[model samples]
Target chain A: MIKQLILIGLLGILFGVFFVSMQDIQELYNTFGKDYIAATGFADTGSRNLVTAILLDYRLFDSLFEAGILLIAVSGVIWISKHESQEKNAQFMLDKFKTPDLFVTFSRLVYPLMLAFGFYVIINGHVSPGGGFQGGAIIATAILILYYIDADKDTNIALIVTIEKILYIAILLVASLSLVSRGELFTNFFVIDASPDTKAIYLVLLNVMIGMKVALGLWTIFTAFLKEGR
Target chain B: MNPLLTFVVILIGFYGLSTSSNIIKSVFCVTIIESGVILLFLNLGNLDGGVIPIIGDALPVGGIADPLPQALMITTIVIGSTVTALALMLCIKVFHHYGTVEWAEILSRESGK
Candidate 1:
C-alpha cells in the first residue's frame, strides 16, 4: 500500500510538471518554422516529400548513425542470446507453435504482395509517404509471415549479416559521394545542382540501401530470438 | 491529440512502471511511455487545418502540418523499438537465470531477503 501511494504521488508530480510546461498546441505551430521546410525543402532536396528530404538529405549524418545503432542492437541481441554448444540440436520454441491452416494459406497468399509493396515504398520514398525505415519494417513483417507458414524454415544468418554490413557501407559511400562531386558531405549533390534524373537516382539508391540494411537487421534479430538456447 | 491526453497516457505508463511486478510488464509500460511521447510530439506539431506535408498543385492555402517533429519522431520510434528489443532480450536472460520474471521475486531470491 505504501509503495502504491508512492507511485501515485510520483506520477502526480510528474504529470503536474509536464502539464505546466506544455504550451497550447494549437497556438504553438505558426508559419515561421514549418513553412520554410514545406516551401523550400522540395527545391533543396528535390524530393516531393519534405520528411524524406529532411531525413535523407539535411540530416543524413544522423540517419547513418541511426542505422549504426540498429546494427549494434542486432549484434547485442544476438550476442546475449547466443546458444551453447550443448544446445546445438535443441528444440526451438518457434517450432512448437501450432499455426492454423488458415494462417498458413493466407501467409502464402500475401507473401509476394508484401514483398513487392515494400520495394515499391522504398523506391518511391522520395515521391510518396513511405521511406527506407518504414518500408524496411514492412519487408521484415513480410519475412516474419514466412515463419508462420513454415516454422522449420531457416535462413543463412551469416549471409544476411554480411549483406546488412555491406549495405551499411554502401549507404555511407553513397552519402559521402557528395564530398567528391561538389565538395560537400551528406547532402545529395544531385539534389543541389544535378538534373532531376540523377537526383531521383541518388535518393532512390540511398533509400534502397537503408531499406535492405534495416530489413536484414530486423530479420537477424528475430532469427536470434527464435534460435535462442539452440 | 490534446497535450493533456498525451501526458495522461505517459502518466499511465509511469503508473504501470511503478506498480507492475513482471519484468515483461515493465517493458510494456516503457513502450507505452514511448508511444505517449510520440503522440505528444505529433500533437504539439499539429496545425489547426493543416494538410499533409507532401506538396502539389492542389495544396491547401492555410498551411502544412509540421514535418520536423514527424521526421524527428521517426528516429525516436526506431530508437525506442531497439531499446525495447534490448530490454526484452535482457529479460529473457534474467528469466533463464532465476526462472522467474517478477522483479520482487528475483531480488528476494538473489539477496535471500
Candidate 2:
C-alpha cells in the first residue's frame, strides 16, 4: 500500500510538472499555416505525404544510420549466440514436433495477404502514411508468423544475409550518386522535371529497398534466436 | 494535446522499471517508456483543426499537423522496437548463464560463485 501510494505521488508530481510546462505552448500547425514542409515538399520531393518527404528526402541520412544500427544489433545477437555445440539442433527439434492443423490452415490463409499488404505499404509509402520502416516491420511480422507455425523449417539465413548486404551497399551507392549529381547527399535530384512524379518514384524505390533490407535483417535476428533457443 | 497524460504514462513505465525484480519486466518497462515518449512527440504535432499532412489539388485546405515530429517518431518507434527485441535476447542469454532472471537471485549466485 505504501509503495502504491509513493508511485501515485510520483506520477502526480510528474504529471503536474508536465501540465504546467505545456500550458503556454501553442500547437505548431496553428501558427505555421498548412504544414512547415507541406508548402514545398510536394514540389520539392514529389511525395504527396509530407512525412515521407521528410523521412526519405530531407532526412535520409538519419534513416540510413537507423538501418545501420539494426544491422549492428543483429550482428551482436548472432555473435553472442555463436555457440551452436550446446544448442539442440533446430532441425531435429522441428522434426520431432507436429504442427497443429488449425494453425497451419490459418497461417496458410493469412500469409499471402500479409505479404501483399507489406509490399503494398512499401510501394505506396510516398503517397500514404506507410513507409519503408513500417512496411519492413510488417513484412517481418509475416516471416514471424511463418516461424510460429513451423519451428523446424530452415530459414535461408545465408540468402537473407546476402540480400541485406546488397541492399545496404545499394543504399550507400544511391547516397553517393546523389552526392555526385546534386553536390549534396540524399538531395531530391529527380525534381528537375516540371512534374514531381519522377521524384516520387525514386522515393518509392528507396522505400522498397529499405523495407526488404529491414524485413530480411529482422528475420535473420529472429531465426538466429530460434536456432539458439533449441 | 494534454502532456500530463503522457507524463503519467511515462512515470508508470519508470516506476515499473524501478520496482521490477525480473529482468524481462524491466525491459518491457523500457519499451513502455519509449511508447510514452513516442506518443508525446506525435501529440506535439497535432492541431485543434488540422488535415492530414498530405498535399494534393483536390484535398480541402486547412492547417496540417507538423510532419517532422511524426516522421521522426516513426523512426524512433522502429528503433525502439528493435532495441527492445535486442534487450530481450540479452535477458534470455543472461537467464541461460545465471539460471535465473531475478536480479536478487542472479546477484546471490554470482557472489557465491
Best by lDDT: 1
The CAPRI quality class of candidate 2 comes to medium
Candidate 1 docks at the CAPRI level of: medium
lDDT of every predicted structure (CA atoms)? 0.83, 0.79
**lDDT tens string, model 1, A201-223?**
87888889888888998898887
Q: What is the lDDT, from 0 to 100, of the residue B56 in candidate 2?
A: 82
**Which runs of model 1 end up more than 4 angstroms from their true locations?**
A23-30, A86-91, A94-98, B57-59
Model 2 chain A worst lDDT window (10 residues): A27-36
Please give, for residues B53-109, the per-residue lDDT of candidate 2 as tens digits. 877865447767778878888878777766777888888889888889999999898
